[model samples]
Target chain A: MDPVFMGQVLVRLLPPLGLTMLVSLTALAIATPLGLALGALRAELSDKHPASRIIDAWVFFVRGTPILIQIFAIYFLLPKLGLQPPLFVMGVGALVLNSAGYQIEIGRAAVQSVPRGQWEAAAALGFDRHATLREFILPQAARRMVGPVMNELSQLIKASSVLSVITLFELHKAAEAISSANLRFSEVIVVEGFLYFVFIFGISLIASALERRLSAAGALAGAGSFAR
Target chain B: MTLLAARGLVKRFGSFTALDGVDLDLNRGERLVICGPSGSGKSTLIRCINRLEEPDAGTVVVEGIPTTDRQALRRKVGMVFQQFNLFPNLTARENIAVAPRKLLGLSRAEADARAEALLARVQLAGHADKLPSGLSGGQQQRVAIARALAMEPVLMLFDEPTSALDPEMIREVLDVMVELGQGGMSMIVVTHEMGFARRAADRIAFMDQGRIVAMAPPQQFFDAPPHPRLVRFLDNILGH
Candidate 1:
């Protein structure tokens, strides 16, 4: 492997890093809010007087299928139905749906960690469901969700590698393109792996820091009791 | 006018009756102390005052408002939880300011000023900017009291406010309650601290098995203790 060609492979992988993160983050923006709403709604639905099964089907359909296949069905098969979304949109569309599916579990777990007494307290304070959830329930849930959501974001960063398979010019695709042309595929793959590590590691650090800050807010009282 | 009235109060959870046909009344500026054995519904009684627990059968009327109107009732009443229940993501000042600002439409400056004064009253003036994590157990409970008081509530409810604190931290919180009692705030406290009850409670209610077995002036109730269960409970606790 010539160091100079290795340099070219490194340069080729650069553009894709930015592209991959941009695409993954854009997918994340679309996925998170929808996932949060669905997760909160599902929890309320489950606790309803006579429980509904529609949410069950929604969760089942999403968690049961493969995201890669979901993307393939949307990209390769949807064109036959006269729904001709471009490759990038299909890629992001698939990622957002997949992201929302996993994110829903994370969000629901966070919402559950919020003490039920809080909802009662807020309601007792005259806040209706909409105001109580908005002011108290969701803010607490958002703090709790920070850790798992960050985990999801890191997962998205790694999963963006898959976008290369659909002819998207992501980091991994650039590595593949340069390697196949130069026949120095091993070196390019090594470089690509390093980029993935850097991206994921940076995000992991940010996630932990934010978790520390948010959980510290009311920490003293719970801790203070034990400390005394 | 009665500050609080519980009429035929009964609470049940899946056949386990926590409170059954209990009735009680509280007057303005009165301090009531309640004590009982484990699962005796002392906690449930105060909890119902502010709508923390729903009575399976009964009515709780606080300051002319029905506890059934939970939202409106809560704004007029304040609760200090055994666990503190302060928002962990907010500073002491912010925790105190939240409901007043949101519920009462107080400006941030007005709420902050009120919270600061309340914190001072609880001897926690220096701790306003700190998080609950940075405060000691006594300090956190003090902040909880300040948070409750910031609402300018017509009545306050304390559910074992110092139970979660260490022994050394108990006196600090008890002293604050005593001061609040002297200042004419109506309050109901659920506690095992007989000393606090004697010093602060105008009336004492002893509960056993989902009923208020006795209610009287503090001295008479603590001295004579009209029922056998009260006698046994006091003997076991005070004897030790």
Candidate 2:
């Protein structure tokens, strides 16, 4: 309730903000391209394809489990498998794998949402499948993907809090330390919550701005008539 | 010279036979119109020729080569769809220029120049920068035609190109096709527009139940009519 105390908690939260961003952005940076490739493969390949089946299994497993369990499993289980990565790497790996699963679905849905006529047109124009996907299909799909991708990024940022259990000091862990020490649980929690809001709301703003910019080019205009 | 040949083309969709042991040949500089009732496989035949649909039986040869290399075959053959299928994200000019730029390795300037010329050819010179959505159905179809023509394809396939257009817009697209036909581009058009068939096609073929029942020069096709099915089709379409 006290303005001074809240301001102090906000400053304490600042240092961990960079760590939170680093983990989220790094995971996002690695997961995005990986997810896009998997997503495109999932969308383009038949459900009967072996690769598609594998991707389907991965998506199913990821969606079915909790992020907290995923984080815990990676943290606790990887050492048993003789992979002793640093705590930061472990946290990032978990985030990337977790986000990549969702990203793949997002990518698949976006790519699949493109009208089939576009594919036919690309084929008729003498483009190989790779060129068709890269040139014609992805550009249109990318526009539709912006919102979901940013949403995933926002979720990943918040999810980074789970890394606290793994001893990676991100935003939430920083807040826990401050609140535990000061015993001003309500004040510290409010400031921490506010920080999370500002971060996510900022991303949402960027997302809508991006959506507007992409749509301004008329990519989505008359999209309904894309198929016959 | 024969520009395209399809022999014993058979395509089955599960229990349905879309094309049943069909055969066709098109000479260079020829414009052939194919018309039939719905589900008669006219579109399937053309789609098979371009390798868009693989036939369960038979081979399509173009310029004396079998269509084993699909990308190469498609390079030589262009197709326009009933729906315009213009890339929604690309402007008309980019839509026309993309294939040449990507497939043929044309420079941007070269492709743009070629696209500009095509835009002019299609009577859409000023609309080059407009996206497909900004263009009318007719204009979009025109852009689609220009996009097809940009490949400098030796033969073109039209699958009911104007069937999706408004009544007033149909002629604009048909006019482009007529002009293209006059320019000596070989084409196989599948449409119900008998007037276009009469105007632009050197030969007209009537199909029913997945077979070509009659084929002749437009005058002979309309005047004498070899088959009873053709007679009924003509009467049904032209009787109005």
Candidate 3:
């Protein structure tokens, strides 16, 4: 439990923070637009809109199955199918699918939470479907989704630890290597835990600030009838 | 010329019928008030005209265009709602400008200028930059009216616009509606305000059980209602 040894582990872990962020943020970047598209399509779901079945199935398959097996399928099985993506791409691919599955639900709830009157108003004003959703609905929904989506991003950050199974040396992989090599399991693990906490705590802080700004920007009617 | 005409309109919710073979017509620059008890389908009829609620049967023609042509129809007709469904993310000005810019291809400055003029018409000139959430209920409803008017719609539909406002606030929204009605804009309003009907409505239609049972000038209808349901409804609305 030497202080110098802990400091060395810290330095080692710090470099991989970039790699960890690279994976999670890239996965998030891919997932967000995909999730928003799926969520928008699903929001209009009804018996008449049969395409939602495909979206529903995709969401179910990704959410119902385990992420570990998904990574394994992409890394191991996909090579047999003549689609051997690099290990980093494989890890990112798996994380994006998993993150987007949850994000679909988050985005759908946020979009639907906008009052029905907004859609009606948009329609009455001659906004086409795309303009209605893009200009009117999505802006409001995006504000509501900010906090929940940040929480989802934090979850993705933690979930990136699972990527080590595919040999991608992200934060947790770096910590495992440092701890086992130095025989400082407790110290390295605790420090690694602290690092993860910092990432999530940072995101939580951003989410709260954004929420406050949004509430102030859209403060309910002077009489406060817009409480919801 | 007719501004709007709905013929044989029918709407149903599962087993219950909301609108049953109803027919309505609006002349250009006319103001018609639709009054009914809950579930009488007055709101449904207005919604169908804008295609907000698709009718199970029949056609709504606005300015000779069928409701099936939703974009064309909507461009000609605007609607205000009970809940004042103003976009929460945009300022009052943006809410009024967005549709014009996106749909009508107005430049930002043009749209903003139009929004300012419309806000002034609705008595919301100073609150242009404020969000609808920060406006009072009456102010929000007035902003809703301005947002609809921003489309330059040939006709307007109001579905209980003041039903959600406080008693004191109701007067402000009603004043805006009265002003718009006198400005020669064609409008169909669903309301229980007998005073608004008497003052602003050229014709009053009383509905019950998904049917328009009576249509007459407000003075004639209020003076001696033709139907027992209308009499009872008037008594209930005017009693207190």
Candidate 4:
């Protein structure tokens, strides 16, 4: 467990860090709009609407199941159905599904948090449904969703570590490889834990800063006089 | 000629009727005040005018257009709320400019210019950059009025616009509203501000039990209230 040897091993793990970043970022990119749409359907639409009911069931199914099992299902089950996506795609897909479930709740709560008066005022001022959501509703809801969505983003990054179980050489897998080769289990574990902490902590800082910015903009509050 | 009319506007909340066969007419440049005790359909009638609360039954026509024609009706009818429903995320200028920019397709510059002028009209020239949270209740309501005026609506609906303000702040909002009335904006105002009704309203419509119990010129309505319920309400509100 020489310090210099540990540094080399950590550096070797950097490639997997890149893989983690790619998978998580891509998952977030795909999940964001999909989540917003699902969230809007849940919040703004009636329970009787088909999409609303579908979202309700989708959310329950995704949230109720464990993320690890979801990844396994996507990795192992899809191939049986003749959809043999690459392991990377399956991993990202699972992350996207899991992240979108959480994001849908965040987006729904944020969107619903906007006062109903905003919609009424927009309508009274001649804005249609899409215009109201685009111009007035989303901007405000986005401000409120910043902290929560960022929290979810950080979670996705950590969750990507689970992708190694599916043969993806993400951070944990790369570290495990190094530890097994060198027999310095404690040092590799500690170093990998530190890396995860750094990544999640960086995300946490960005989220708080964004939260501050949104609060300072008073963007959400400007929509109405509702006290947070 | 009527610029806005509601014929047989009806609304219900479960078992409670909020509005029943409500009929009202607004001519261009007319200021009409609505007054009633809480839950008397005063707010409901004005809300139906803009389709904010869809009437359970009946037709609302604005300048020969039905409420079913939502965009047409909305563009022509602007509304202010009791709680000053200013877009809380926007500054006074943006709140006033958003509709015109988005709906009227005004260029950003043009909309901002219009917002500036309307803010001046509401005597809020110094507060254009302030968000609703930064402003007082009175200032926010004035900004709300300015936001409505920015639409250049053919008719304005004020639903208890001053009811949420403090006694001291009520005058400032009322003053802006009075100025709008003098400027010849057609208005349907729901308020218990009898003085405002006295000074600005050409007609006063009193509601009770989800119906207009009396409708007359302000002076006639004040001097000789037709309904005993209205007389009692006026006495209770104005006696102080």
Query: What is the DockQ for all candidates, taken in turn?
Result: 0.36, 0.51, 0.49, 0.53
Tell me the tens digit of each residue's lDDT in model 1 across B125-199: 888888777888889888888887877888888989899999999999999999898999999999999999988
Docking class of 4: medium
TM-scores of the candidates, chain A only: 0.86, 0.92, 0.88, 0.90
Instruction: Give the best candidate by DockQ.
Output: 4
Q: What is the lDDT of residue A128 in candidate 3?
A: 77
Q: Which segments of model 3 are wrong by more than 4 Å?
A: A45-51, A203-228
The TM-score values for the models, in the order shown, are 0.88, 0.95, 0.91, 0.94
lDDT for each residue of candidate 4 in B1-240, tens digit (9 for 90 to 100)? 779777888899999999988888889899999999999999889888888788899988888666568887888888998888888778889899888877788888999999999988888898988888899999999999888888888899998998899999999999988888898889999998999999999999999989998998988999999889989999999888
Residue B24 local lDDT, model 1: 89
Tell me the lDDT of model 1 at A53.
Answer: 60
Candidate 1 on A155-211: residue-level lDDT in tens? 877777787778888888888888888777778888899888988888789888877
Instruction: Rank all candidate structures by their TM-score, best first, as comma-separated numbers.
Output: 2, 4, 3, 1
Identify the leading candidate in terms of TM-score.
2
Tens digits of lDDT, candidate 3, B139-238: 9999999988988889999999999999999999999999998999999999989899999999999999999999999889999898998999989989
The alpha-carbon deviation from the true structure for residue A75 of candidate 1, after best TM-score superposition, in angstroms, is: 3.1
- After TM-score superposition, the amount by which residue A138's alpha carbon in candidate 3 deviates from its true location, in angstroms, is 0.6
lDDT of 2 by residue, A70-109 (tens): 9999988999999999988998999988999999999999
Please estimate how well model 2 matches the true structure, expressed as its whole-model Cα lDDT: 0.90
